[model samples]
Target chain A: MMEPSTDKAFINLINQNLGIAYKVSQFYFDDAENRQDAIQEMMYQLWKSYPSFDGRSKFSTWMYKVCLNTALTYLKSNKRNKNEPLQENHYHLPSEPENNKEEELRLLELAIGQLSSLNKAIVLLYLDGFEYSEISEVTGLSKSNVSVRLVRIRRELELKIKQKLNR
Target chain B: MDHLEIMRNQWQGSGKHAEFTPFQENEFSTLIKKQMKKQNHIIGRYFWGTFLFHILIYALMGHVLIKYGIVSSDQLVLTLSLFGIALTFPFTAKLMIEFKKLAQVQRGSIGVSTIKSQVEIRYGILSRYFRFKKLYDYFLIPIHCAIGAVLSFHIFVPGSFSYVSFPIISVFVISLASCWYAIRSENRTYFKLPLEELKGILGDFDKK
Candidate 1:
């Protein structure tokens, strides 16, 4: 078995990929606890499988696959869907920013979380600088399918942002 | 700027979300180590279980053969029993490697969806071995028992025929029940309605 990397190497990798965990968790979960649980689970799965990643793919690409797969399966099978929603008292979403850009960003996070798992994958890949071919490779979708879904995602987010802004 | 452009910068340079505070960093690494240790313990437990189970099976077979006087104490019942026990070693080693790989891949504690998606992609290969394990549990034991039943009946109870029906019927019933339990375990959650109206409860959070 391949030994774990030295602490310096491991820390470097963690610092690089940690954002992937946060973004993926944010996309899949609305509640902070769920997000944390999802992140922890993904990390657990990644550590479990990290050694055999034979450098064929970029490390980030492999990391994306590991994170997305873990989150999707967890969201699909988890019993948390049945838990009562947090009362309005539970979460302290920071006060809404006065600036339009920051408010939009905040709303975008919430809206994106509402997307279906597949759409979230498309959006995340697109936002992360993946071209159509690359997104297809990561997600097992055809390039044409990725393109078509991305159009739909853009339109959906536009409508959602407009409605939220007007309200 | 278009929404796409703004979102892209936020997504790409979203370093704040990705960056771990010192406390979170410590907690996550510790959790990963604990998970690895648990996996190693599970592998060791399975190894001993496989080794002990076959030994007990063979010992019982030996005792039966000796009591019936078909073979002396020094004689082996069948070389096949030893071969069957030998087969478990390869599986045990493969499981160890798999567990090791699983632990190493998760070193950073990334996120849940990515982890699950990776596992699903790899499930194609993993499922094959799991299927073999399920077969061993579901089919192998009863077949072994059936063989013992037939051999004892043929050798020691030539005149009695009542025991023959018990083995076939009992094995079939047990196998069916086990299959039913496995299917039920997979399907149990599909029946519940989830707490889908969280937005309504969160109320003004949606407005903000």
Candidate 2:
């Protein structure tokens, strides 16, 4: 299953783009165990899908697509997952942060938790600096749809975050 | 600042969204390999597990029919047994074919596809399997009672046919009805809900 040259190159690419898995899982899964499961699924998928990387697009772009796909289809185990509160410990997300940033992050996460998974993915991509076209390609939504949803998501998120903060 | 502005500012400034501790080469490969095995094994177990269960039931039924010596004279009873097996064949075939397709889909490079396509594909395979299972259960529940009725008449009563079979038939019918009720209730709650949730997700793509 491992070809030396190809395997070497795949591992290198995965190591470089490991952040994609961490970030997507961080948003999609709230708790530690589910995050771990999501990461495992994404990593396994990325490995299996390495040969299909046509190199036409940036490696990160392709990795986002795969990770997002894995996250969306991660339904079987998700049914069994408990919807728990966010925890601080993670491989990438900092264990400690400045007080304001921590408060903001917590409020942001709480508001984000109210979203459906698809909306969460869309919002995450937009916040992470993905253009409408890339978000469209990853989500299979039209560019116009992405634009429209982004507008709505921004409003909804602001309302929810404000409400949460006030409480 | 607005929510989007704050998010963009924090996400980009902190680089937290795009930062991770890199995995060592050995750790990366080993972890991926282990996950691959666990995931594949879990899915594989379901398919083979159900296959084993259905095979066992069929073997036991076949053995009982032969043991009763139905092959010698009771052509109608033998035909019914054969028909029951034949009816099950298509459903079993559909199950195997669908499971194979699902396995191929998992092993294929479908991970790079769009998220909508991925969810749709998984939902599609699962819903189809559920549909077939519901239909199979419908046929199986009654046929089971029918088999029990005929076997009781042939084996215990020791007669060519009589009004005495009516009591046995009543018992089997009641059992069959209860089985059907239980299955329908279970399917309505369990199967329909998840499929509806998936459909609801698809609906979100179209929401105004």
Candidate 3:
């Protein structure tokens, strides 16, 4: 159990870092309902494991570990029930008129969705500005392993984007 | 800009266009509490259910041993009971260890590597358990039939051939064959798929 003050502080931290939840949910899920469920599950896990957050790492770093684990677990369980096809139309891209920037972002989301689950986590961590060591820490992979995966992920993304742009 | 940087820039700006439903703290707290309670209930059920099942099996075995006496004239039955006890003790010990690991996982604060290793260990344990079960099932039918035949010979045809009757032998062979087929089919459908999925997730971490 936490003191009221501690609870308040934790909630405040989450409030500030809510963007982490949103970004992760968006990257990992294609539809709004699934994204919402992922966010809820992540927040629940974060809260459930809140007491273990020893302030040695940045709260966001810890948040990344918790959020990514939750999303990975969510995806694994969901995969058992549904075989998601990798089509851009399946993603809930912003429903507004598609400008060039929106198209690019849509392509990026589609590309991210198509990556293998572990690769998706690596790319999301990379884009979130995590250093290799930090990504390794959160993902339980060695730094060199993270680097190798990141290099492959970047190449894959570049090719995916190029193909989409050509189309 | 390089492809990576361009994508990173887009990722950073991506949320700007996303219209997230604002999270209500009160509602979230309520949901969290409910989820926590549900998780606790599930853990409780699994732990207690396993404990009760073990107790029930042990009690039944105890009753049989006490009723028949440990040193039975039927040497085959005595040997079977002793074999069962041997298997049960080790199985119970392993189950306790698995339950302890599961409880540790439920009680949070562990690192990602620790959790991953725990999951991997649990998977190994389950895989081994299934393999043992398949082997046990394959042999159990024949063993039981042979035992039944011995008892029947003692009752019906005293001082005769102490082997299984031809019909029982046929049934035993057919059952053993079917058990082998079932294990092979189930290994592919029920076990291999999940094991592969788990390996895929763990493979990245294993590369180092």
Which pairs in model 3 have colliding backbones? none
Cα lDDT listed for each candidate: 0.59, 0.72, 0.66
**Each candidate's interface RMSD:** 8.6, 3.2, 4.3
Ranked by DockQ from best down, the candidates are 2, 3, 1
The TM-score that candidate 1 achieves is 0.58
Query: For residues B1-208, what per-residue lDDT tens digits would candidate 1 score against the true structure?
Result: 6586688987677655655643255565676766556556755664565556666766766555556434543233343344434544455456556545533344334332333244443443344445555556555655555555555545554454574567545655665576557544533432111112222212211121
Chain B TM-score for all candidates, comma-separated: 0.45, 0.76, 0.53
Looking only at chain A, give the TM-score of model 2 against the true structure. 0.80
lDDT, residue A155, candidate 2? 84
Q: Model 1, stretches more than 4 Å misplaced?
A: A1-5, A29-34, A37-62, A73-111, A114-116, A128-134, A140-142, A155-167, B1-19, B22-32, B41-56, B69-121, B134-139, B148-159, B162-208
**Which of the predicted structures, 1 or 2, would earn the higher TM-score when compared with the native?**
2
Candidate 3, residues A1-167: lDDT per residue as tens digits?
22112256777788778888988877777677777778778887787677777788889888877787777653455446554735766864566636876676667767778887777878888887788998877777778988988777777877887897897
| Tens digits of per-residue lDDT for model 3, B51-169 | 77557656655654555536455565455555555656766776677556545454245544432553466467557755654555565535544444444444445454535366556
Q: Considering only the true interface residues, what is the Cα RMSD of candidate 3 after superposition?
A: 4.3
Every model's DockQ: 0.24, 0.47, 0.35
Candidate 2 TM-score over all chains jointly: 0.83
State the number of backbone clashes in model 2.
0
